[model samples]
Target: MPDTQLRPLRAFAESLRLDQVNLTERWMRAVFHDTELSDADRLTYEQLSDHIPAILEEICGALEEQDLDQVEPAIERNARKHGKLRWRQGYRIDELVRELDLFRQMLAGQIVQFSESRPFFTRRHEERARHFIDEAVSFVTLTSIREVLTERDRKIDEYTGRLERANHELTLKQRLVGDLYESRMQITRSVVHDLRNFLNVFSMALQLMSRAPAKVEAALALANRQAADMKALVDELVEYSVVLGDNHQAAVECFDLRGLFDELVASCSPAVEAKGLRLTAAFDDTLSTIVSNRLKLKQVALNLLTNAAKYTKVGQVELAMTAAGEDQWRLRVSDTGVGIGASDRERVFKEFERATGDDIPGAGLGLAIVRELTRVLGGQIRFDSNEGEGTSFEITFPVRLEAREGGEGGPA
Candidate 1:
């Protein structure tokens, strides 16, 4: 290779790199500034020039068929002589070919105009020049088309990726919705099962009370008492529904715990006597008033005493209350009955849960209601029991007295 031609080719390669560098800087600036670039920008800047061969074949078939002209021979020769000047410099080849085509066309036009003015060397030279110009134009057009196709392919790939991500997100959301629906259905089924048991118990009690009213008066009374227990169970279910349905807290007021216990004992005395269970109440009248829903507290105490009386047939059940601390009092209901198993103690507080099925005539809402009421009053209730011996429940509540000015210390 001659040094002269090699030096020019080297200079052209360097110039191409400089052009690419400048274009890259502009591309970065446009992206940072949030300026959108079009397909025309990609074409004009030669950004997608890698697909030049395919583009040239599509857009300029005449160039592929044409014999090597003087410029084509020179380009091939330089590519062979210097490896850097080969078609591997794809963008440079594309740009240079495009410029050559434009220049050839311009020269052909000038030659035709000059030949038209002079009538001597008329059509032949003009036709040959036009053919060369057409071939050059076709080659450059093909290169441009290939570049455009490459850009299109890149866009399609990006679109496909985005679509896949969207589908994945949709599937995740659908699974979450299905899980939520299943959980809701399970809760509904459990509630329905509990209701069915309570209804069956009420029906049986009503039928027994109607049959042999005089001859089995004691049994009838027991049946009626069981029926009343079912009614209370239903009422508690209603109350629980109301509490969970709304967001309102229970209305609290200062109340006498001792007085509340007195009312509960009086109300449950009939049931206690009927069951042959001895009932007793021991309290300190000096106990402070507790801040709570008075009606709910009374219901809790009544349920505890009834439960004690129901379980204990021959032994005594006692309701004892005393001041536990400066601002709290403790109430304990102890009974000598067939006590709960350790494993069943916690389960007893859940709705429709019982230690023994078909033995105890209860829908299992007593302890559940007790727990709910205690929580509503900001109090705590706990129990201790030995199976076949007895059980004792201790309840604690904060004190808030209204008539703390004057009161005698005595059991109500």
Candidate 2:
């Protein structure tokens, strides 16, 4: 193909933002075939640069021998190249016919203006050109409308996907809020129930003091003890609330678990003696040290010991320690008291949940606080009990000296 002939097509393809390499190849092929195209036809095909190659091939093949075998192939090729090839949608075929008709009319007009010597021939060509132009224009318009609709549908799908994700997030947030509300309500009920029990005990002590002037000393002592218990309950409620409400860091320390137990036993000796309960401590001297929050651990140990002493009427309340594994030790506090029922075992660990019995006194926050404090110290607490027999509470803590140090430095 001559460089001059290819130049116009190349310039037109560039104007349409079509690839230069692809347009150059198509233009060269057309010019090399020695196709009969007038100056006006060539210029119009260049202006409609994107459709030039397919339009030319279709028109030329239609004018050839009437076998019509090449027609389907040519239509399929153009359709596939434009990504519009679909048997169910005949849009591409229609577009090809329309463009060919436009090309023929432009050719006819060029012949009429330049061929005055052959007026009859120019008029005949113009009539043929008009017929093809009408057919081609109708098809092109249909295909273009379909393309626009496809784009609109794609955009709608994208928008619908975004809406679905937003709705899913809203549903998740709603569920989380509901869970938070329920937990808050549970905590509130527990605090109120514990406070009511403390008030009842205070009232009983005051009445006892009023009825017997000779027993005033004993009544005042009992009242003071009840007041102290109430104060401890209030403090626990506040601490638990603080733990749940804020992300406060706990102070860590290394101490002897046996020593802590000894201190708690000494502090509660008066209560044990008053209740006429025997308190015994059997420590595994080899398994002593544990790194944890010293104050919290002390509270847990004292609470469990006092609880055992409070409920037991006769026999012994034993605090025993044993090695659980290579790096863990178990501390079991067993009491020969009115044991917990099977159904109440699990519930007792929850705040304000007490076994159904008339003799048991004070609020039911001791075991609950023990459970919470044990968890905070990175340990586990479990119990074994048979109603009318006895109850045993076992707590496990890591014992390895290195592990104890590591726990001291770890997050609470």
Candidate 3:
């Protein structure tokens, strides 16, 4: 008779002990099912269920205790680990909290269902079972929060550190103010392209976090990286305006063509992959170092590559540099992208003009920048294209720097 009286209390505790595997699976699915914490979808069932079974065991132990201290240490340890793991995995604090809150509700509801199903688990046992679940949940959430706070600095470091490369290199959507405003106008439009590109990535991240939680981690990481890119662009504005002023000469320095093209390949890889396009870089082994403005050279190469990668929806993008002749090297970028039309050819290197349709994303300034920079580096730029086939652009630069070459690239 006495054993029957204890049935209500021990029944819930015993159920937790025996049904932990199923309970853990339920909690894991709940996480996966949640819309706000959608990033959990990326995790495999095994990874998502880490430490859950053990945490349930601790909760079972806690339910049998007169004072909660007996089992809290174990719960705290596991809860803290879970928190750390999620934070490192790019979970927002609110998402983490929501995840735990859902578990607490699930655990509480399970107890209610158990008591209502069995005649022996009366109202008397129902209240006590709920109290134990509440205690376990509240304690677990508190421990998890403390661990999350401790790891917050790591996330901050990620934002302030060296910028990770951007996936889409050319988000070239900038609204020019109709008529060009000369040099200052050129400076403003130049940075507007960069700033807009970064914001586009951030916007994409927010959208993914809201609608497709499974992609939250990658989206957030990309946003974090672009934050640094924005900062760098801001810092460069002061110097950019000064360097490219009406009278000032662009700084000239020698740089290896091989090293520079490799960087462009890395930056453009993600965007190329998204279009199912193959991107390859090749330069003749005999090509030696070129004496030119490294900054102008990089900007020229980047603009051409970005334009090529962004417009080319399929096939491949290729960059190649080879020795053209005595003291000359030729750089070429070819793509199986939609080629420039006969009508589009007239606007190819004009400011705010594109060699493609209006629907495509471009600042229209990319080719303009490429043309001027190519001229300043003592290079001649030309291309051949067919409307449906693709385009090949080649720029040949003299190995020896010309005296007046540096002055040509400054603001028009």
Candidate 4:
């Protein structure tokens, strides 16, 4: 590299510096077409010139020094800045490449003008000048492309993170909806089971009153009690929809336990007799009328009697009321029925479960309801059974005495 070989290239680089902004403006006008970009999207002359002057100065220094080490860092910085700006401004990759091409052409055009006008300019100077511009273009374009790709990868990761969060929220909502549906179904089944029992008892009382004209007074009294029980059941159904609360009522009313048992025996006698099972009731003379929800007690008694008669095909079923202690009493239903096995005793208390052997006509809800009723009354229920022999269920609870309510007698 002789001084003669580099002098023309150095002069061309100097001319580019003198006219850098004018060269960028000319390049912008040639490439920034109205069809490709609007005034709002087009970069200004200062932005277009970016590091061109500094780079031209470095190229001039490289002409004398023999290497581009002084310009490489500036070239990299300009490329990265151009990449980021174009990416944020929504410029296409082709548009960025075209802009670089126009800048090179503008510089080359200046080189051509210098060679044509100045007598000392030659072909070698033109070739070296083009090579310098080409090298700088390659470095800037590669760095710009790398910056653009980095930005794209960052956007993809952000989008993936957002999608995962949205999926998590959707899954949570689905689970909550499923749990709510299950809870509603359980409540519906419970209400329907309770209402069916009250309605059945009401229907039975109506039938008994219609047939027993000789005992019309007693039948009417039983019908009245059954109607009241039906009303309470309806009220509970409405309340259950609003809130799941305690099932027992605290309203105290006087009613004869013996009469309640007598009514139950009467209503269930037809069903028992149809099965050819003898049904016997023995009430203690000292067992006074109780002050409690008579309808609830009647419900439990009816459930027990019905279950006893249902399974018993031979022998008999007995309903007994016995004094248990100073403040408690026991109501027992013993039957010569198909008894439950040890494996089945606890299972029988669960909803929709029945003893294994018998295809007895039931929905397996009678004993479940009875057990719930026992709990509602602050009592406990237990049964002793010898498989294939018999079962005796005893429900023992504190007797709420009529005297506590300042009432003297049973149902008139």
Return the top candidate by lDDT.
3
lDDT of 4 at 180: 73
lDDT of 1 by residue, 1-412 (tens): 4554333223322332444444344433443333232222334334333333222222222222334353454333332322222223333444444433443444355446556665643465446445644665454444434444555566589998998998898899899799668755644665566557666756665676677556466655655766675666567667656544534556667766777877877887788878888888898878746776688667778778877876786888988888887877777898998889988977777766667655566556677667776666556788999988989998886675332222211121
Over 1-412, each residue of candidate 4 has an lDDT whose tens digit, in order, gives 6887777767776777777667656766776663554432456666655655555565556544545677778778878887777777676677767666666677778878989998778887677777777777777778888888778788889999999999999899899798678756865675577567766767777787788777777767866776665665455344333222443243467777888878888898898888888888888888886666676678788878877987889989999998887777899999998889998876787654679542344446677667765665656787899888989999886687332232222310
Candidate 2, 1-412: lDDT as tens digits: 4564333323322332333345334454443343333322333333435544564445334323222344645644453443242222333334434444444444344334434543333444444433443343333434444544565467579998999998999999899798678767866776676667777877887888889888788878887877777777677677556544434455567887777777777887777878777888787767767766778767777777877877788887887878897777887888998899988876887655678563455546677667766766667777899998889998886553233432232221
Better of 1 and 2 by lDDT: 2
lDDT score at residue 406, model 2, on the 0-100 scale: 23
Estimate candidate 4's RMSD in Å.
16.1
Regions of candidate 2 where Cα sits further than 4 Å from its true position: 1-236, 242-246, 400-412
Best by TM-score: 2
**Best of the two (1, 4) by TM-score:** 4
lDDT of 3: 0.75
Residue 123 accuracy (lDDT) in model 2: 48
RMSD of each: 16.7, 11.9, 26.7, 16.1
- Per-residue error (Å), model 3, residue 214: 15
**Number of the candidate with higher lDDT, 2 or 4:** 4
Ranked by TM-score, top first: 2, 4, 1, 3
The ten-residue window of minimal lDDT in model 1 covers 403-412
Candidate 4 deviant stretches above 4 angstroms: 1-8, 34-66, 119-121, 174-187, 201-412
Error of 2 at 278 (Å): 1.2
lDDT score for residue 90 of model 2? 38
How high is the lDDT of residue 323 in model 4?
82
Candidate 3 collision pairs: 38-213, 39-213
